[model samples]
Target chain A: MEFQSCFDIIGPIMVGPSSSHTAGVVSIGKFIYELLGDYPQETNIVFYDSFAETYQGHGTDKALLGGLLGMNTDDSQIKYALEKAKECGMQYQFEFENICEYMDHPNTTIVTAKRDDHVVTVGGVSLGGGLSKIFMIDDEMVSIRLSAGDDFSILAKPYQRKEKVLVKAI
Target chain B: MMEIQSMKELIEACEREKKSISEMMLMVEAKKSGRDEDTIIRMMEERLIKMKEAVDSGIKDASTAPSGISGGDAVKMSEYVRQGKSLSGDYISNAMSFSLATSENNARMGVIVATPTAGAAGILPGVLFSLHKNDGTPYKELVKGLFTASMLGLVIANRSFISGAAGGCQAEVGSATAMAAGTIVELKGGTPQQVVNATAIAMKSLLGLVCDPVGGLVEVPCIKRNVIGTSIAFSAADMSLAGVESRIPCDEVIEAMYKVGKDMPRTLRETALGGLAMTETGKEVKERLFCRKS
Candidate 1:
């Protein structure tokens, strides 16, 4: 089951107006951060369906940005995540869509993040109760469920791709 | 090694192991997470503390949220309750005030535990805290009540959905109320079957409820619905404890909720394009907030 712990339903201890829009999105961003091994230098976040529709009221944007900045779901900084991102010089942009062909869920986002010369694209859906699942990673359709309080970094390691490096004889 | 897909399975597991629903959940969690029981209990205790903190801060702080649509209702409710003139008795009225407090805190994006989901966060805390206040239930027992609530929520979530975007208010508040009902029953020494019955009865009461938030925020109807959910939870739990059985089973009720949500119009979901979001007043609120921001 995607939800394995009692805490999965009862806790996540997050700053939130909505768990699916806020806390779940944070876990998705956190998974991207884990896959990249750090916060991205520049990121393009595409919000689909419900996420695009009510992001402002629910603070979905702030939550996602907070996660991309390497903050956990419960971090109070999520309220000021935009300013924090600007301070950190973490370049980010948002794109909205009526639907995501990559996924059927309304609360979905495809985040393309770059750290140094390495880049990874992850598509995730917030499945409510602060549970999220990554449905796409770099064009590969993969299902990785992220429960709050679990170690997403370790959970995302297998999906991490080694960037190809070229060395010329000096 | 029992696989729990439905309330029936959960009840069967409880009977087979001679354990309470919370005990069953603790065992399953211990096995699934490979963590010691003490560690898991400590984690739940931490969540309980956060929930208490939110209620404590909210009942006294009447400041408006960023949207200015919701705030101070919790404080108002607490004042009304303090005057000793409530019709729903101290337990239900106190729960309502606490639910309002917790939900108001959630609307402000203050720290709180999502009892299944943040929009429905207030109900569990409202009920649990009221139990503690009125009946002198200890913190340790309250933690076990959380485990009981989670076991029921896990089944509902796995069977259906808990997000308004996926389902509707029925799924969010409804699932939380169901969890709360079961929790109340478990805490009151009800049987596993009674807990499931209470859950079913509570969920059935809100089967087709929609999630039409005004201005797309969790304030407004969201907070009030959470407050009402606690009363429903208490009523459902009382019925279950008194030997009332749901005509429809808990699993079937959850399945029906899932199917109804699938058939729900997108406007009734979290999308701001329809339902209360499109109301004249709702549009005005959105316009005011938008203008202020821009």
Candidate 2:
């Protein structure tokens, strides 16, 4: 491709103790929460590959649980999500398994949740460069590949419901 | 007979074209100035023509070498590159000295790329040095390769994010190595096609490489990964120059990387709860380190 005076520089001013571990999981968890349509009394998250391996050390568990608890990407409560999970009375457990078995990427996670009868199983892939894609939801695969720029909603087609509640970015 | 396509050829073409454009503009500007217009135009034309000839010659002589490092080894190597030596080599030794002489009070964040996040930031230098020293390549071409690689990285960032915690090391060391590989190939005078090929090869080879940092730090495995990444990048460049096409396109590989990362269990990505971190050594290291730090 011929170079066309590209001038899009992302400045560094983010709220994060760690951009990848903390913020990324928050985004994925928040996206999952969005897919679920409503808050669940119970959540069972099975972190495949990389997600399960490092969730505790990276605080991904907290990020995911905090996000499900309606926390934003920059929520300070994320540090306390594990302890608070019990206080808030939200039931959750993180497990691990090789989903694809042969692929090289280790940052894949399949989050399945049930809000009463509304069950949602969404697959989120965190491709490097702070970008991620939600590939599936509730057995029905969602083609929500994360592209450059803000196309979050457009990618969330399968998750869209009449009563879908959109949470504001934090 | 028509000339074969090569990276050197393409870059030289672009350079020649750029020179021609510059010369033409200079002539137009000189004409507007209304003095010594013919002299200025002639000089610019001559310069442009010389550049074109050089580009043509450079394209005819490009060879490459393949990387032998494995997917995991690449990551380890990248980490090693980051931790600069106490003293050695031209580029890094100087950079290391400068880093040491400079006080931490006024230090800035160095984008280590696929290198070690801290301690050593010499992977790029190492890759560039190897390309220049081992391949007998010119310095200017290296700059162009770096520029091209940066552009590719921007595209990836535009398309997706490269955070290790978010996307695992595939985003961190993985993307950085890919970026480095693309640059290396470009420097080797590979075609844009080869540049893309090198990128895919690097990314594909490093697909699923985890960010299992021991003791929850960017040290250890992280530093080693940087060294490996630089080596892999060099190898990728060589492979591309040798006409090895990475069957998958870079974009698709990137997408697949994302998909595969999504399927990865959280343990391996940087939570320090999987892989080596989960091992006995990892646990002991973490216990000792965290206890000391706290």
Top candidate (TM-score): 1
TM-score of 2: 0.48
After superposition, the stretches of candidate 1 with alpha carbons farther than 4 Å from their true spots are: A164-170
Clashes of 2: 66
TM-score per candidate? 0.97, 0.48
- The weakest ten consecutive residues by lDDT in model 1 chain A span A161-170
On residues B52-82, what C-alpha lDDT tens digit does candidate 1 reach at each position?
9999998998999999999999988999899
Q: Model-by-model lDDT, in order?
A: 0.91, 0.52
Worst 10 residues of 2 chain B by lDDT: B101-110
Q: Give the Cα-based TM-score of candidate 1 against the true structure.
A: 0.97
Candidate number with greatest DockQ: 1
Q: What is the DockQ of candidate 2?
A: 0.07
